[model samples]
Target chain A: MNVHEPERRLVTLSDVARAAGVGESTVSRVLRNQGSFSKRTQDRVAEAVARLGYVPNRLAGMLAGSGSTAGAKLVGIIIPSLTNIVFPDLLRGANAALDHDGFQSVIGVSDYDPEREEALIGALLSWRPAGLIVTGLEHTAGAVARLRASGIRIVEMIDTDGDGLDIVVGFSNRGVGCDSARHLLARGYRRIGYVGHDITRDLRAAKRLAGFRETLREAGHPLAETEIAPGPSSAAAGRAALGRLLARRPDLHAVYFSNDDMALGGYFHCLAEGVAVPGRLALFGFNALDIAAAMPQPLTTIRTPRLEIGAVAVERLAADGPAETVDLGYELIAGATA
Target chain B: MNVHEPERRLVTLSDVARAAGVGESTVSRVLRNQGSFSKRTQDRVAEAVARLGYVPNRLAGMLAGSGSTAGAKLVGIIIPSLTNIVFPDLLRGANAALDHDGFQSVIGVSDYDPEREEALIGALLSWRPAGLIVTGLEHTAGAVARLRASGIRIVEMIDTDGDGLDIVVGFSNRGVGCDSARHLLARGYRRIGYVGHDITRDLRAAKRLAGFRETLREAGHPLAETEIAPGPSSAAAGRAALGRLLARRPDLHAVYFSNDDMALGGYFHCLAEGVAVPGRLALFGFNALDIAAAMPQPLTTIRTPRLEIGAVAVERLAADGPAETVDLGYELIAGATA
Candidate 1:
């Protein structure tokens, strides 16, 4: 109903053939390199395709069993948050690798909702992508079933906590949490608290909190006070969460945040309130985002292999192998804050 | 050729009709609300569709003579970068709006390459999305021709200097640049410098630089110095650009950066090198990003209406009418930097 007019048809193989002054069969053979074609014909067809900007419909060709199609090269990548630098960084790596490998990415944002993720997965699957790279292992049962039945390569990213449908590419979120707790404990911070968005909804953060509490229990410190804000983690949310935590327990030695956004917010709060950094309260966070190091006082945090994970995910998809996990571990940046 | 095995077919209208205990014609009539159908038939058919997850292929239906289907609900959103926080934030807003209206976004990243952008445009149009939302007004002639021929809702986003194919939704990059220059001049910074990435590739940045120079020339204070970095703007790149600018003209009173990323890097450079911000050298940038306000000193920069542009683009697509240009406008946040 919204159509203004009929679209001009796409430049097809026949058009390329006509433009190149060659038979359609010759053009197909040249494009596919299936049956032998002369060098002159190949050059002519290539030139014609360039002039026409003829991008073959790979999806349609894949379905039609055309010789010229290299099957499905489109990789469907679904992530949680685009505003969160982590997801974009992840896409950067995937895109770089995919571009080099002649693969295109069809991106879908789930907005941290598994039901949305499931719907997106179904839509992406309908397009018949070569691979589906989704954020985290957690998914609705329907999503899991669709993924398992799709036959396409599956790559679950960011959090490596559950069994993947096919391949998994990321470090252990739980380990990152436990390690943060240990780092704080080593710094002689007993009254360490937690500042993050709602963990139950964000399962990865939930895993981190569980690991953090587990380690704190071992150290007999326990979680001094916790502020779990109910929504997306942001610098503002982080600042507010920190404010709430401090109001309840002003003497908490330090706080472990869900991610760098919250940590940055907390850092801003300290700057705003003139709180002595480590002298009064130490701060630690996950995802050593670009801003972390550039800050006046660098944020002490864990840098996950976000880009590497994305790159490896695409690389694995290109390799076309059996199900396996590539544990690109996280790094600990011990800045002055902690 | 790379198929692991055969796949199941998409849910057909025939299947829905059979499941609903009606003929295919009745089902189509009920679904499209064309020929009259009993209320009972409509309910049964709708229930069957819901139970079957029958997403009618919009492109196919459009070709097959259906005024319904909205033709397509998938909006193809093309941007220059995924890592640039600005683009992501724009996408966040677009996605929210699109999702609210029961539409999905198919995102394509061109990484600031016009040729890539052209290719991506072709690929996106092949899918027959309801609308095409692209980053800038700049495009290769071939790309412009393709977009004009595509016959979908074409929205040129971010920059609004050139004539759009259909609807234009963004602020003027030149205006942003001129405003920043005027803002800096009012602060009495005569020996003004610029730290930026290669503007030739980022046409929007080029317009800003041109406008900045134009304003400076009118004021009889030609740009004192400039250091254009080679690639994408980053804090690291910003620091280096500032370093280069300072090495040549140490007495430069102020430096305007391409965007906030470079500005933040310059800010960090001053923080690390013990140079007093605004006292030793005033700093200014475009795109008042999130970290800008939350920083130790809020960044003095322009905040383009990124999210609003995205939201409005989709809204325009949904509304479907005559071509229009929306000047969402920009804001100059007079922070302590200048």
Candidate 2:
């Protein structure tokens, strides 16, 4: 449980060059090897560097001594979670663009905690990153204030309908929900239930549910029953919730899950219970994850452009100023389940 | 894309103090506010920090004033993948232990690339972490040499059979596979087929397959067929693999999958085709993931103590240098499927 503290001496390249008895340019050249330098100079510089135990300051190189007044080419990205494949694909696309432009990207996982997100922002800001990308627009009061006054460009991702700080990049979750409701209604399914997990934490899911209910009300049909899980949505929890819902409302004709994970659980439940899918009950899900399409009756769900959202967020950050909002639309993959 | 380069020199703590006409330590204390300081000092420090942008260096603070001596408190973790739920559960357990002891953990993902693992090791070493918790014992030549020479501590996690890199904390994948075969044989299910992703990338899965086959041969029941996927295991790929395997071996009595994802896909495939599970073909999986248990008919699989592995790995790294090996056994969960 020992906290291994960091070394604090500001050992500059000048000190290494002085110790090596070489010019500053010679030391820089030997270290970076970007310019021509004699082998002897390289050896001497290496020896001095090893002796002094100097770690070169990449930030200093990017910021200091530039005639033009431009900040360092760095971007900070913060995501809710990395356990899911969605965020990784996002990182992959953003990494490709950042690497191409020689921009260093520092990432922090908030684990869907707003306080943690704020703390992470403080850490990321310490590097003075040129731009910042966050998972969603919902933020703590302190977090919002700091981000507002930080003067750096900001980009909120994954949900675009919220009031943005500067740049917004994502799709409309509400629209996806309305579309899901209409699809289910058109199929003559009147008695429908809703299964979700922690709707408050995932604001987008709440919006989707709102839209779904609105559409149902307009059509003279109401949701059969709403079941909410205690925590993060998992396939197991989804299955259990669906089982409970079915027990309570046996007459339900279809179910709209908050996302694909829960819907998959519902699908599995029906299979285990020997209930014919679409004949006894139809199923719908969101976030057309890979598993959804591979299901026995492919899950009818909405596919968010996760990778594209990440890539476009970076591209917008790289633009001259902050972008107001970029609505990268979603896709509704019609599968057999619904 | 024009990179949104900032147009200003980043203000430092020293600049802030100078602007406020105060000592650097006073500003630091006021910002951190760990100890008592006058209200005037705090106000002046805040004003100075606001006037001149200054961000604290967390890395520098953690290391400042600490000498070159290594501490035995840190448990560094390196996992190959995060997409699977197994690793996150492991991290949760490990973090609980480390957090209780006031220890901080730093982690990196290898993405199944040995070279990337080696590079990540180098980056992790810069922090001078006390002990290393690597994924598998199979490391590249350079990585092995560096780890051996690093002289801190090493604990290879999630596998125990092959070789030892200091302390090994996991069960034998081969043993699990062999046991699975015995379970199926006792039930009179023969003409078995195997479905798996790239076994070479995941050496553990390969070992399991080998053990399963060996057991089957010993029992005079050979594998009728196997469907090998080209890349990482996914539900889509698993579904496709199952379809191909069934098309090739329609008479197969049972099928064993690399993990729960593949098993789930196979289950979905059977559901879609109206293939009676157990009556026609039984399905078995590994890891006993949460979803597997929640499935309509719980997945018949081996349950490895993934979270306990993580907790024990951290404990070993903190308590002892390394052991020859530590065997954390596996379990067989007989669900309705098999």
User: What's the lDDT of the predicted structure labeled candidate 2?
Assistant: 0.80
Tens-place lDDT digits, model 1, residues A1-338: 22555545567778998999999889877876888988898899999988886766443455555222366767899998787888999999998898898777778888788998999997777666778899999999989877876667899988788788788999999999999999999999999999999777788999999999999999899998889888888887888778888999999999999999899888878877888897899999899888778766789999898889999999998887878888899999998899
- In candidate 1, list every pair of residues with a backbone clash: none
Per-candidate clashes come to 0, 6
Off by over 4 Å in 1: A1-26, A39-59, A66-70, B1-72, B100-102, B148-153, B247-250, B317-320
Residue-by-residue lDDT tens digits, candidate 1, B1-338: 12354555557789999999999999888877988988999999999987876755433454444234554667889999987899898888898898789786777889899999988898787666778999889899889878876667899998888788788899999999899999989988999999999888899999999999999989999999889999889887898789888999999999999999999999988977889998999999889887777777888999888889999999998888789788999999999899
Clashing pairs in 2: A5-B62, A5-B63, A6-B62, A6-B63, A6-B64, A7-B63
Docking model 2 quality class: acceptable
- Error of model 2, residue B96, in angstroms: 5.3
